[model samples]
Target chain A: MAVGIKDLAREAGLSVATVSKALNEYADVSEETRQRVREIARLLNYQPNVTARGLQSRRTNMVGLVIPTMEPHLSDDPYFLDLLAGIADEAAEHEFALLLTRCAPGPKERTCYQKIVRGRRVDGLIVVRTRSQDQRVAYLLEEGFPFVTFGRTDQGLDFPFVDVDGTQGVYDATRYLIGLGHRRIGFIAAPEGLMFGFHRQEGFRKAMEEAGLAMEPGLLARGDLTLQSGDVAMGQLLDRDPPPTAVVACNDLMALGAMRAARKRGLWVGRDLAVVGFDDTHVAAHSRPSLTTVSQPIYDIGILLCRMLLQTLQGKPLEVRQILLRPALVIRESSGGTIS
Target chain B: MAVGIKDLAREAGLSVATVSKALNEYADVSEETRQRVREIARLLNYQPNVTARGLQSRRTNMVGLVIPTMEPHLSDDPYFLDLLAGIADEAAEHEFALLLTRCAPGPKERTCYQKIVRGRRVDGLIVVRTRSQDQRVAYLLEEGFPFVTFGRTDQGLDFPFVDVDGTQGVYDATRYLIGLGHRRIGFIAAPEGLMFGFHRQEGFRKAMEEAGLAMEPGLLARGDLTLQSGDVAMGQLLDRDPPPTAVVACNDLMALGAMRAARKRGLWVGRDLAVVGFDDTHVAAHSRPSLTTVSQPIYDIGILLCRMLLQTLQGKPLEVRQILLRPALVIRESSGGTIS
Candidate 1:
């Protein structure tokens, strides 16, 4: 029942195009006519047809956030949720809505990207949970579709990506445990297929090699970076003959699991087992023996990723392709302190 | 480069229309032509233009989920996350993408709805957290928009919805506490604005009334439904002249908070403050003392809501407008004794 330009023009005895131009603040419309058109449109509650406007301008002002299907680990991972809050908050601020699509990581994902691109459903995509030599990245590039990555890829082919300093985050966490006079340091690695997971393992090995410590293949247990998997990995680690006293999990959930494993064995967390986790999520602080971990500003990354995608969709040339946020180690009782 | 229909048709020595008809499985195309088109399409990696097909048929194959934006109590509600996971999982199965939008509950929410509707971004909407006299529902009805609600509203408009049986959940939890020989009962309420929160309180009242127990206003405390808020509510309840032996939290997080409060006061939970919670989320099991709570099939609700919307989009009569999924109570040590 809202007023259309035709109705407004007929009422005012003006042309429909003139009515539209006047209300839309075109210079061709005189001040008197513009005011008259506005008054009429206001009375009629004439909401503009965004679809028609979008068709003409070729801009939807909508950015799509395509998170790889919440898989075995990512779905349970509160990390993505925290990050989503940040991205959504920023998108709301910029008057942009995130068309969220949770697609499976492999070949099945192409359907969503195809629909999004051809239907003009979204202006750009925010790619997340990057895999080694990710097909999505390559697909976007080949299709000339605008997108930004949440993590860096192995090829390092320049694309707009906002990622954590994964290798450095591991380096700092591992180096801290090493500096605490611990030589028999065991590492909990992330799943093999993940890009961040690979980077973290590399960071851990690089630190050990730099310190002239032999990387013990036996000491490394690959966890899916889930709390449950962490528990399983910890059980494996603790069962080793007079197991390594200290362990560094690539993520906080794994660290918590390790803590649980130690407790089950009737061992004090800080005294018998020194454990550290990466990505100091909320659970890290509330943990019984306050987890010693690496803190990454995840919320900030989400906001930056959204801003970066907007820039790309707006056809702005990004001077920098990869922006890595540094993570700092937070020392707590989990790294062998008075368990107060 | 991936091939188009024109390329496929040219390579196969067929007309573009014949190739299209063959790929579309139209009866007009000969079997030989269809086989030839398929081979060329597969060999050349000619991804189908789903959007173009959808446009011809006027179907976007996308649904939107609009949840209440950051409410103080339920803003970070873990329950919503579980429900979303279910919806996302089901939507993926049916070849649908979800466009997620968040808006604070107010008149400003209309803008978000308008964007989705007029922009033709989504085929239908999945609404969670409906309030009494919801403006969104009214708007949808006025415009003849297809939608499904996750929670029922006070308006009693029989719109398509999938909801956990809140009354049954609360009644069962309350009856379980009563069976433990605890006459005095306290209900920790979430923000009253939530329809489910109000229903939870109603169930608690019904259980008490059925037992012919006189209601005490002193026993009722409002919790924002977070663990911290639950702790605060428990403290307030304890401060009352005569403390209730058993407390029933609207959700598990609040129960966890109450548990922590009991621990801080040097009171054994199972011994002193018998507690029960609702919506048995993953955090419910992970909590210390493993809370006894109501198990609402959140994933099932998500799937049903999506399926309901799918049916509506496919021109199916929404024969089932309101769906109430049964909720079962999970008895754990937090509720005091093992109830058989």
Candidate 2:
């Protein structure tokens, strides 16, 4: 059996009520008595019940992360893994534990949030994959709960967030393709509702307009950010009256899928067609012919988000409530570019 | 302000004590009163404090997973990510939250375990990366805590665990290499203390002894399961008087590292120096000269471990407490083998 406060009281020759007050560091308790009680408790190896103490202090020293597993292939993407590693490492450094809750994207997601928030299971939360008009962000704001997001939501609420400049990243990739003398370029965009989708699409359009290239409706295809979706989208684009000489995908997986589609159609990636991708995941560097991608420091973003959330929890005024990191375009064989 | 039990009591026209009794479903409360209190709570959207409830019930409904971040490059490996996804998905199915705590291996690791276990912060735990005589495992066993390990310990404890047959996996790879007309085979083993290290090394030795092949001590090198370590180990092996033509790495990252080392020496991986890796991770299939590896369903093992732990927590007898999964060898170009 584990030692308890009652045992500490008996060992210290004090009343149970007196020992409790001393252990809890109540102002009514004498400082010398409190110290003596704590010493005896430590020697007895008494572990205070965390839940009971949390009731009194109203602090759990834990942060919650709710992952929406609506996409079946969510785990296959290493982005979340990198983000989780960063958060976990930083949380450990601060002596805080991270509580993870997984739920589907609809009503269940709200219930998952409520359980953690209403129950006060965690002191703060770290939100990811924020969409335009994200209900999760709105709800947290309404409740005045502590949270920091990894992406921006268009709910017009002032909240702390860490995000990559997706428009800049996609714009750079598009300009790089145009610089390679590829006028007819196709785009594989992410599905609707994601904020990055809006930013990245704007970047592509800005780049194309700057080059005075006519927008082709047939050249734009939306993908669910999966390899299969990218392959299907690329195939549709290839079937158009005049196929594009180059393509840019919103993510590395889709870009690899596009490469696979090109290969099936008897086209060599670097020679016959050029491809670019986002999120320079591990597979991007190792894939055959290698993928050129926009690199976002996802792991570091997680660390930063956790730090911000911790600050918010402590009621510290944030020096900067929002951080938008610049994304760099990494040139590789897939982009048909010489590494300068 | 969030609705509390006091609010529910006021709205329901009952005393706080009676409202609490009804909400708690105590036998002393009348059935009608209980129904009335619940209806009022639902109407007011009252969420009970989870910590207080946990203290009363002695159940947190949360499972802890303590990841050892001693290895700096842990996030770079997707194995943990896959495992976490499986566990998180399964945990969500059971309405249990996963609490992640990261700590460097050694005294700090034991402290992490103690905080969660002694504090009763979780209902159960899922231990990973078991060592030959893991102190965590021993401590958990001594405390009679509910836990299921991803790997086995050699402490002779009758505990629940799910492990891949590392010996069989290595034996199969070694035998396959021997069958390929390669007499000199190099082994890149994992560092000492890991339980899998012992089993895998045994498998390599058993296979060599069965084939009447002389084992060269200089051909065997240990790596810390990182890409850089594998590169250094492979470089050392290649400098030997008669370096092995075929190499098998304990993991895909190390195998890729070995391939890089071999390429630096002007040797084609498939044509000149054959390589085999374990844990057919995402990078293994996309890598140039695509890796031939031993495939263990790491994600599925995580799911199974979680299920077993849930059963243990429920005090249900596990149908099969100790599960040893077989690892299959996947043939690819890296092993100089045609896929059959």
Candidate 3:
């Protein structure tokens, strides 16, 4: 009972083919004819059934998100929520639905992706938390599938991605501590495999070198991005002959843990030892002392990533594929700032 | 190319119709004959194309979750993350995907659901955070669509659902505080419209009445289930004449906020003013003074809800339709307990 192209064609005094071309923005249709056909279509309230159109176009108008559930508890964090919210925002605007799958990082997960892609379950895919020499990227690149990632891989294959400037964020964080008269600064680094860990470590090293500070072997401790690990790492740092006056954790959870370590040792966080963190998550702002941290625009990154994926699916030019966003430093009470 | 039923029939020395019935678990097929056909099929490595099967059966191995974007920032909370994790776990086990859509509560959102239901976008849906007289529930019930909810509605329709006993949880919270030698107990309640709010408030009142404790008119304050709202409500409670020695916030975030209020008033959380919260989220354990909370196995609820929906879709008996799980009270440091 819905208005069809024939109705628009009859009203516009044109053939069904011409009306279709006009409505679909075909170059064969003249602007005046397109306008007339569009006006008639609007007058008749012609709403296209997207599913039927999708079947004809060989596109499902659905985006696939396969989260690696190797660490099932990781979903308990706000990171995924922020990313999903951004993608969901853009998806609602485009009238596309997100098809989410959670799978382990194994051959079974690979098969799941293959099924989704080969079966035409989704129009495109959005991959997140990319690792070095990622197999998913290699497979998607080889299959020529439409896909985008939140982070880049070291495999050197060019693809669509949006990443935050972690190196600059850490550099700014370290420099901020230096300006606070902290000569011996302790660093809490992330485990070695992640790309952000490498970039952030480099930033810290460069900042220290520029300030003519000698790196103490006991000053830098590696954490597995957990509060417990951060607490242990901070304890090791404090056990040294002359402990550092300030500490920088790669993530906010770790920074919060570091503060707990300081408190356990009966030292004021901002006064005796300044502590700063990365990611500036909600907990950072609400913590008792209010954490000083580097903040990535995670929601914005998610929005941009979805937009980039949609553009790629639409066969947009490759120039808009790569995007890099700056991470800002938010100074709060934990860094000895009273202006929280 | 995979082996078809015809090949299995030929190998098993049975008719194609018999082979088909055996493969599909038809009750008419003999157990011995079915075993013979299954053995031959397994030997040949026959793999069914799920999408093709779905087209024939009209059952897409997909579930729907349309989160109301009226509170978009709500997704940022751990509550959503935990719920999604549970659902994702079950979906993965069943080889099903989740189709997520974030839309506002309005006509447009209703149309979105209708399209998904009528257009066969998903086989079933999972609705959460049930409000009074929810339209989604009404629409789903009216259409006879397969669905399960995380919370129950007041409409009293018999359907599949899995909800924690929030009333008992709050009642237990109030009783626990009273057991800790607190006579004057203050309450930080959730806003009136939410079904849980009503249940929890009733629980608190019932427990208070059972204990012969007089609840003062000035002791009750309402919060919107956020940290800021909890902080505000706690402040109001503290301003009362002879402020209560103990407080109960409806959620963990608000409970944490209540703790902040106590600290602001120069009172020790465990020693001076005991605070309790609901929903033992990740931050509740990691907070400065670990929160005492009512713990609902949210992940388990998700799994059960999905199982109920799947069973309904499969035309299972209604005996396993509704489920209500108990919420346990976890006493931690914030309630003056060292046993976290």
Q: Evaluated with lDDT, which candidate comes out highest?
A: 2
lDDT of 1 by residue, B1-340 (tens): 4346788889999898988889888999889878988988877767655444544555666788776766422224666656776777778778787776668887778977876775566788998877767888888877778999888888867677878888889998898788778888888998877888988888899999998876799899998767789999999987886778889999887887887887788877877778889988766665556679999877778888988899888888888788888889998778883232
* A239-298 per-residue lDDT for model 3 (tens digits): 987888899998888888899898899988888889999988877877767899999888
Best by TM-score: 2
- What is the lDDT for B96 in model 3? 83
* Candidate 1 TM-score, C-alpha based: 0.88
In candidate 2, how many Å is residue A116 off? 1.5
Clashing pairs in 3: none
Query: Would you list the clashing residue pairs of candidate 2?
Result: none
For model 3, the stretches where C-alpha displacement exceeds 4 angstroms are A1-53, A261-268, A337-340, B1-53, B262-268, B337-340
lDDT tens digits by residue: candidate 3, B150-257: 888888787778888889999998888888788888889987667777777888999999999988889999988888889999999999988888888888889888
True contacts kept of 3: 0.32
Return whichever of 1 and 3 wins on TM-score: 1
Model 3 per-residue lDDT at B216: 88
C-alpha lDDT score of every prediction, in listed order: 0.78, 0.86, 0.81
Q: DockQ for each candidate? A: 0.26, 0.65, 0.25
Instruction: Sort the candidates on lDDT, descending order.
Output: 2, 3, 1
